[model samples]
Target chain A: MIILDRRQIEDLIYLPAAATAIRDAFCSTSRGEVNLPPVGHITFPQVSGDCHIKYGHMQGKPDFVIKIATGFPQNAETEGGTGNGMSLVLSATTGAVQAILHDEMVMTDMRTGLAGSIATQALARSDSRTVLIVGTGPQAMRQIESHAAVMGDHLNFEVWGRSASKAAQLADKLGGRFAVRSVSDLETAVRSADVIVTATGSTKPLFQSDWVSAGTHITAVGADAPGKQELDVNLVARADLRVVDLAAQCLDHGEMSHAAVQGLIAGQDVLELGQVLLQAATGRKSPGHITIADLTGIAAQDIAIADVVLKAYRAKGGRDV
Target chain B: MIILDRRQIEDLIYLPAAATAIRDAFCSTSRGEVNLPPVGHITFPQVSGDCHIKYGHMQGKPDFVIKIATGFPQNAETEGGTGNGMSLVLSATTGAVQAILHDEMVMTDMRTGLAGSIATQALARSDSRTVLIVGTGPQAMRQIESHAAVMGDHLNFEVWGRSASKAAQLADKLGGRFAVRSVSDLETAVRSADVIVTATGSTKPLFQSDWVSAGTHITAVGADAPGKQELDVNLVARADLRVVDLAAQCLDHGEMSHAAVQGLIAGQDVLELGQVLLQAATGRKSPGHITIADLTGIAAQDIAIADVVLKAYRAKGGRDV
Candidate 1:
């Protein structure tokens, strides 16, 4: 068995490969040939721990991936503690325990970021240049990195955080690659940017419907837990194209929850990310259309990244038996 | 994080103190306060891999354990290959990824054996001496070790396996202390044994109804997966005391599946192992009564053992940050 620490996994597996694999898996899953099961998870409000276990085979792939991830209240940095650990188990067709990945938190961040990038790649217009990133944590940084990687070469980036100092620090870290600037005004950033990414841990909507402009792409990466909202229901209702990782999950817990509660977007109106990836339908048909991609994360992404990590370990002469 | 190899975990962590902790955790879980979620597992009948992802917390425990175990068909001969590879992620109440255990297979074996030992201690009479072990696999060996350790003093042991060499090998290895003998006839071993254990991977019953003697205590540990049976339905029907790890799981998948299907025993007749352990009711009231413990391994056991392993690692100077 191969055991990989965070650093080892990061160094060996790149985000581009992982993202591509995830995109492929998502498309395959939509085709109904992939054996991905409905996720089984439990939220223990009393103890403050929630876990999701997901497993399945990617169509035409030789191996299967099982991901077990848990988030505990005690591990929140804001709660004066480190966050809970996450891990993935990758096994092959021959039943060998190929790799045990120890960098679950990083994996989660990267895969989640890639989901946003994939959505933007499909939904955002090619000429879209200015991007607004709300939140200045690790997840926000990863979103910036992934968007830059997928969009490529020419785009202006703006950052906003609850703390001005943190926003300034994030702007400095961007290193003038895309006219990085700190926006003291949230509305100004939301109105001007061609694309917006929200990575906050807010329990209420941070963006209002009036702040959003026409012809902008929005990626909502936070609001994973119940009662957590980052975008107003009106904003969600106004979007011409709304895509989700899993429609059922999003309606239950994603930004779509608010829209669903308001009866703005019915169950049938929400399109799955897989459908968009497979090109079975259009994502952004017009240049002036408002598109929103609500990502609550998916297990297929975990499995895809795990497969990449396992392959990298094998290439580096990792032990087999 | 602390990552222990199989041998290191075995040598440094296994102890009576750990066993006691696990037992206590198991007992507390039966009180209905802890929420142990159902495990997510996949079976590859097309190939031969069996993968399981289990997560839960013991009652009053500070950490949650999530274990991923996979059995490889190709490496079944290695020390731990027949069983799946197990990894434990310890998420403490402080919300830190406190530790990562890499040798969960060994810990699982120890904990599973302890479950049987704990059941026998609570259910079997003090005079029960002769032991019969069916299916001479690693699990059978551990069952023998645990039973001998818990039962103490003089005990006669007989082993039966499909392969005569395997049975003889186990007998030779454990012969000195327990007066171990290899028996060609399974019926003879079952009839003579006061305490019988069935740990085979067979899909059909290994022990017949006529084979069991009165007052015998049987621990069936191998019928964990669906359609895996180790004792005849009639034998279960005649059991005076029927104790199970989890009645729902046993009725759906374990040795009790056949009995329940044949209408031999009602679902309500199966007693939870914790209920029996707490002595809410008698296990074996009369000297001539027959008893059976159907152990379909539970997620709570994984949580219990993970607690013990993490504690042992910390006590031995292991660190996680």
Candidate 2:
């Protein structure tokens, strides 16, 4: 079996291909061709750490993947500081392990980043050029980079965060090749951008309903846990189309849950991102359509990315290529 | 992280220590100190294989474990053959992975054998002597060896199988150090033995209720999946004390389920092996007490054995030693 450490995963993971694989995974999922069991959540209350075991396999796929990921909020005060993970890909036919990817959270970021980009590509207007990203964390940065990779180089970016200096620093990093601006006003960034991606870890709403534009596509990447909200319930109610990375999970714990709890939208009304990708369901109704894609981060994306990474590794003749 | 291949697992795994760890795990489980999620069963009909993801952690323990096990029945006809597995032990405090034990299927066999041993020691009468084991499989052999290891060297053995030659061969391998005899008459073997351990993969009952001797402690190690049975319904009802490795699981797919379905017994009435170990529940009531331990197997046993194996590997100072 092959092992890919963090550096190897970083070296070989191609964002464009990852986005395409993720698109297929989501599409397969919507078509009921994916077998993803309910995630196993083990909570350590004493240390406030949680480990989630997610497994998934697509029909006719050569491999199935199981990922163990842990998040410790207390790690932020210490040197370790947060989440890390490892994933295994097993041969479907013989039930033998194929590879052990010691991704160390890189694949997760890559998959989520690609999910955002893919969603934007399918749901956002073709002529859309302005982008606004919320937060300045690692996830937010990856979303910006991955979106750039999938959507081409002509788009301008507006970065917003709680910390002004960090937001400016993020804008400066992407300033070399693109139009980058750090915005202090959240409402202005939300209203003006053609594509809005929210990646902040928040318990309260950050954006309102009226601030969003008519043709803007929003990818809500945060609010993965219960009681986490990125956009107000009114914003969700105002969305012309609501899509989810994974419908079951997103409806349970993602931003959709907030809207569902408030009776703003029923879960059945929400579309799956895969459905939009395959055109089995509508994505953007018109140039003035407003779409919301709630990102809960499913196991299908993880396995799909693992397949892409391992395939690349094999194509290059094994490790360290 | 320490990775122990088949050879390393064979070298490092000590059954007596594993039985004790398994004992602790069960005791903790009965006391509700163990956090074990429902086993994730992902079936692949295309390959005729299935992968089960199981996770468990005992409160106040330093480690938690997740095991991914797959079974492909068609592999037996081909090269790969039946079962393969991998497990991870994570730090309970930080949720950081501590060791990766690439134990093929040795730990599984060892753990199951140890479970039989532990259950026998705890539930069987102290003066137990004659032993009758059905089937000449690896599990049946291990049960004989492990039983002798725990009970005493004074015990005699009777081996029975569908083929008398296979039974005689098994007896020949064990005859050197102990009183081992191959018996063709199943009734004579069942009636004369003080302990009966059935480990066959039989779809029908292997022994009737009247054939069983009084005070005989039976460990039904076979019948792991649905529709598999090694003993008749009457034999199950005849057991004075019915103990399960895990009550919830056994009552669903194990021998207890058979009894429960036939209106012979209620699931809640089945005793837990851990309850017997902790002395919280009655084990053997008298010298003539007939007992049955339904060993469907569980993640607790897997994690417990993982703990013991990892500790042994770390104690021997690392990778090779």
DockQ of each: 0.36, 0.68
Model 1 agreement with the true structure over B17-98: per-residue lDDT tens digits: 6668656765676777556677677776666667767677665666667676765555547656477566565543443455
**Segments in model 2 whose C-alpha atoms lie over 4 Å from true places:** A76-81, A172-181, A225-227, A319-321, B77-81, B162-182, B200-204, B223-228, B319-321
Over A188-303, each residue of candidate 1 has an lDDT whose tens digit, in order, gives 88998899999877878887888888899999998777878999899899889999988878999899998898889898878988999888977898999999999887777877
Give the C-alpha lDDT of model 2.
Answer: 0.83
Candidate that would win on lDDT: 2
Taking chain B only, the TM-score of every model is 0.94, 0.91
List model 2's recovered fraction of native interface contacts, to 2 decimals: 0.64
lDDT of 2 by residue, A52-90 (tens): 888988888888899888877676533223667799988
Clashing pairs in 1: A74-B95, A75-A82, A75-A83, A75-B95, A95-B72, B70-B84
| Native-referenced Cα lDDT, model 1 | 0.78
DockQ measured for candidate 2? 0.68
